[model samples]
Target: MALLRDMTLGQYIPGESFVHRLDPRTKIIVTMLLIILLFLVETFQGYGLIALFIGGLILLARLSPRFVLRGIRPMLVIILFTLVLHVFLSEGEIIGQLGPLKVTKEGLFKGGMMVTRLLLLIIGASLLTLTTSPIALTDGIEAILSPGKRFGLPAHELAMMMTIALRFIPTLLEEMDKITKAQMARGADFETGNIVQRAKSLLPLLVPLFVSAFRRADELAVAMEARCYRGGEGRTKMKQLLFTGRDYAVISLTLTFAVIVGSLF
Candidate 1:
């Protein structure tokens, strides 16, 4: 469940561009809208439209495609695996058969659709994270959950936990990488071992990581209490959130697009 704490989005880089200035809530909402529309899209033409729309977003955010691709590089292997499985194993009207395996037009179409859907999901969500700051994202979450706090929902506490978790993801990843290397240098043999042996090799790395994470949590809790930190109650924001004309324009466009895509399917 480390991902429960880890931020999947890219490290937020603050800029004075049009994207950075939009209200966090608006950004979050638009991102959700985009993802929903992405799944709603059925035809290949619809997917193309979504791709162009996302490209426009990346352009608006002023981020390089190289950097965005870097964020998704780690996921490519899994995506490829999925694509391969879908392409080879799926059953359809026989286009060819060899050694108990069949390749067909339906299989090809299904596999291509799966791969395309996955790519759209990953890239679209990555765009959201690439453009939004952690603090702003947390604030957006808290604002969305504000109403639930009236029923003792612990909205602020959850947000605080998420904030700490997001903040430490990179640090923990570096630590894990270092720990892995250190174990390797000690003849841990993680790579060459059988599945069970490889799994066993991870214990040396994981125990210390868990211990360190627990210690950090304890220290952070103490530090928060020492500073008289409380929940979101009665706390005023340093920056007031406001929706701009650009936000309205983006939302209207997304909603319209979503309706069109739904109708197309």
Candidate 2:
């Protein structure tokens, strides 16, 4: 349950900070640019620059560093697995040994760099959901995809689907946690077995979770129908999206930073 609560990727925190006030489109674009930069950079110095940039954004947003970083807890297993695989499997000068496995200097460097990249990517993406509301995120994504409407794209539907998936992440996690606890109270053992056994133990939990998710979906659909909800055709937004001067300035600065970082170390 604690682990589920620590998951913040799909959660939003309301605030009046500069980052929270930026146009959703601006935040979305900057996040994409940062993710692109993360993949493009190789050197530690470049990663350091990106880290600083993200840290600055966190400060500007006035978000708790602990709260922001808690989002990484659920992904720790994947991160560690990547590090272990790289260390044991990558060929290079052997730096150490564990039983039959050899650890190489190159492997260590590569693993550390990969882990750093993953962390930065996670944090950068989390910031988007942390600061932007679901409605605004949907609006921004739809607007970005609107250009494709000429090619028969269902922009609004696509955006809504993406947003809903993200929005439901925490809800589903909480539901799973609750079901796990309930099953455990009824003498179900989920943590006392090997990988295969533990997975099998989850069968009971998954059954209830799926039923709950389907029920919620049905309820939401009925509620939407009750409200006379339709697709985006001829629909209008109550709060129109407008890019202010601050948005332009931020976008320009982000692009300039990306170019400079790409050209430099």
Candidate 3:
């Protein structure tokens, strides 16, 4: 599927822009705050403001608009499904009807709101990963979770697990693509069928993909053990994270973004 290649999770784009230069921790925290703001955005005005905010950030990061938005393509089905569910299931003044289901104004409003929220969250996270390397993201997460160590939480381990999972998304997708192509080359029919037939055809694809994933996991575990890896106890970082004036500038910018959306929007 061409869609697999468009999935940009956990990948980084190298750049010399201000966004790429900001500390990973700063990006993580600011992105978290923006998500909180996204939830509170209820009005079309709010949506417009957020659109501008995300658009500006995308441009600032020197990212291609098409590339960044490409990740959303695969999610269209789920988005439409949610919209339809809301249209049929939610109650209010019925503005239209599709067979037995009634589409209400409130449902339309909510469906649009739900779409906006998902889009904002998706785009925001994509922007973060697009600008920050996976290693830097791991470091940022560990730093954020370090405070939980006082409560006996395995912060470093948790961060490492999260990082590994995020990092594997693209890798595993690529592996599946390769496997699919290989199978197709051998005359395995995947595209010439009805819905059920096509689904059955994918059974051959999934088995190899899962086997490859488990094998990779086993190899990773063995490699870690060979290096004498244990839990995150007594771990030391090579590069100590420090907040600088630029990081504070990020804070100011986030605050400005909030005010712009909340007040003017």
**Ranked by lDDT, top first:** 2, 3, 1
Residue ranges of candidate 3 with Cα displaced over 4 Å: 162-219, 259-265
- Model 1 lDDT per residue over 1-265, tens place: 3443333456676677777777788888888888888777777888888888888888888988777666556677788888778777887788887777778777788778877878878878887777788888888888878799889888888888889987888788888888888888887876776899878878999998999889888998899889877767677889667778988988888888878876886
In candidate 3, what are the lDDT values of residues 6-90, reduced to their tens digit?
6786568988998998899999988987898888778988987788888998998999999998878778898889888887789
Candidate 3 lDDT score relative to the true structure: 0.86
Candidate 1 lDDT for residue 25? 83
Work out the TM-score per prediction: 0.86, 0.85, 0.81
Q: What lDDT, from 0 to 1, does candidate 2 have?
A: 0.92
RMSD of each: 3.4, 2.8, 3.2
After superposition, the stretches of candidate 1 with alpha carbons farther than 4 Å from their true spots are: 1-8, 150-153, 170-192
TM-score, candidate 3, is: 0.81
Give the local distance difference test score of model 1. 0.79
